[model samples]
Target: MKNSEEFDDSFMDNEKVVLQSIAEDLRTCLPVEAMLPSESLAVEKAQQNCKPTVHVDAFLYDEEAVDLLCEEGKMSRDYCLLCGSHRTAPLGFISHSFSALELRFLFQNVLPDLSGKMLVDVGSRLGAVLYGGCLYSSAAQLVGVEISAEFAKLQRMVMEKYDFTDRIQVIHADICTQTSLLQNADVVVMNNVFEYFLESSEQMRAWHCISQNVRKKGALLVTVPSVQEALAALQGKNGVINIHEWLEELPLDYDVYLGKDTDPESFKQIHLYRVL
Candidate 1:
């Protein structure tokens, strides 16, 4: 990855402004709430009802809108902004920026008070969470583990650009199976990355691997596309576990709770925990 500190403060500020503005525009057009099912039911209610729930259009923003938004910022020419998942045809400028949404959600809940603490960013695609965490907190150490080499390189470039080489390190490794890269962090954050594991076994393996790295009495903040929320919206499976219940199922040595509630429609929830 290449680093360029040559840019003046004004230039950096402008770039930030441009990026933020683009994000804001995309959010306005493609709101997260729209993707959820119209009728909302409690977790228990949906589970007991055992009825399939109706869903709204998952992709609210058309391709044209997404394209226009990206073209203005040079984001249109590249790969997916979120996760670098794949190349989708551009609409106006309403392309899927769920990754951005994920970062913003974390900033609101977990970014504060990170300084002086060691933070491990799990599934650190493009290092968005790593950079956001550093930008928000005065954390003494920042470490990122990403499964994709391309995203790892992007993350390296991003951290270097922000002059975070001294405080942050990015590695290419899978969070589900390998985590020797970070074993002493005070905090570990996994942001909606759990779903990529594909199977329950993989998820459990990944969860165990990451939990082993956190120090006793340290903290773990996680966000998952809430299965409860999804079932609540579709299939009326409200009998499922809520965020608190979901956290309880995790094999951990600490107390966990729903830290912040965001995007109820899409069923995304943030969970915070303190290792005992």
Candidate 2:
């Protein structure tokens, strides 16, 4: 990343405008809901197993997008019970991918400069992080491992549409099979990958596979909700992976502001670790 202080305010503003434009263009390429038929399993799992309240995917629709949906009368921030009675509560939303602001925060704030680094996004749905990295960092390679063939096809299409083929590559395969690539990665990002999508047993398997391979000394591992929080549920099935010995948790400065589209709580969920 270049020194933000060196650039004039207008230049920084223009940079953000460019990224926002890309996000808008990407939105036009997909369905309004942004949940494709290819993601039926994930959508079903989210509906049945996620929290008791309404669950909204945060990847495709950020806070700003949600507000627009509310304006169109298609979605609501709060649902009224008893046929539009006054009693209502805010909706619970969840997402598997980073928003554009979050991605900007990631590339500009959390992670170090990636002038010649190779970063991999596990379960890289919609290639949001890849595009953000392409815009914010000078990473040599931004690889995405996605299990769904259709989603992978979508990612490739976007890459081709925006001429990002040189920097980003989408591989339609489960992340467990990419041991060598993980080993070679300078940075690996996992955004609440398996909790909702996989059963307890499958989560254990994927976590085990990740622990064994992404162990290059000093490699960075970024996870939403922290590694300990994510892996705690897998306790009984996951005696093989010990995070304290394998990775060291690093504190992040969530005090920094990314943009108006991002909230403070959103920044707190992101946790960074260093491979030991």
Candidate 3:
């Protein structure tokens, strides 16, 4: 990873333009209805017509471009249309995507070069992490496991629209059932999936499954909450247990890269660990 001082801001300025253009194309496919009962045919047609010419390499090395893409990606979501009405309120799943700025810091500064590594995103909603990998890291493969068929389809469409099928793949299946992916992944990113998406028992099951299947010894695991917090919550319910038996926290001693408008404290919640 290069130092922040070594990077040129002009490169990011150029890439931001290309990334923003791509985002504009993706927004065309977002359904107008907030709570869609079914997939819209219009959305599909819009995606087919949207041909994103920008390549991932255009923004891969620019830190500022990450913030730009992240902001633009927010437009892809379907918002609640009836928030102010007495009969209906704005209804939709809460956004669970990580900021692109944080992702750039994680992959480019925290982890070693990912030239031949396989990066897997658990419960990948909207494929934000996958896109971050495609545009910021050199990982050989970027895989996203999503349980929702709709979300999975959306991710696939975005990948196709951007011509990223060569390095990105989305699997429409529960992460727990995808043991092969877990065991084979060199880097696994779990971004607030367990806390908001799963019940208490299911969360335990997920942790147990990952502990048993994920690559051992050297594999990296990134999570939104600290390992201590997760272990404490589990232990409080099940009595004292040794979480160290499964994973260990890796101190982030390097300087985190941030965009001009980004606050460094915003990413203090992120935690990195090494699989045991």
Pick the lDDT winner.
Answer: 2
Off by over 4 Å in 2: 1-15, 49-59
Error of 1 at 84 (Å): 32
After aligning candidate 1 to the native by TM-score, how far in Å is the CA of 160 from where it should be? Answer: 2.4
> Worst ten-residue run, lDDT, model 3?
52-61
Per-residue lDDT tens digits of candidate 2, residues 1-276? 233533433245554665566667667776765666766666777668434344455556777678888999987777555566898767666777787678878998899999999999998877888888888899999999998787788789878877899999999998989999999999999997888678888889999988999999999999987888888878778575789999998878877754334476788899999999
How well does candidate 2 score on lDDT at residue 95? 75
Model 3, TM vs. native: 0.70
Taken over the whole model, the C-alpha lDDT of each candidate is 0.48, 0.81, 0.66
Against the true structure, candidate 1 has what lDDT? 0.48
User: How high a TM-score does candidate 1 get?
Assistant: 0.52
Clashes of each: 29, 0, 0
Per residue, candidate 1 scores C-alpha lDDT tens digits across 117-145 of 87887776545556656555678888888
Winner by lDDT between candidate 3 and candidate 1: 3
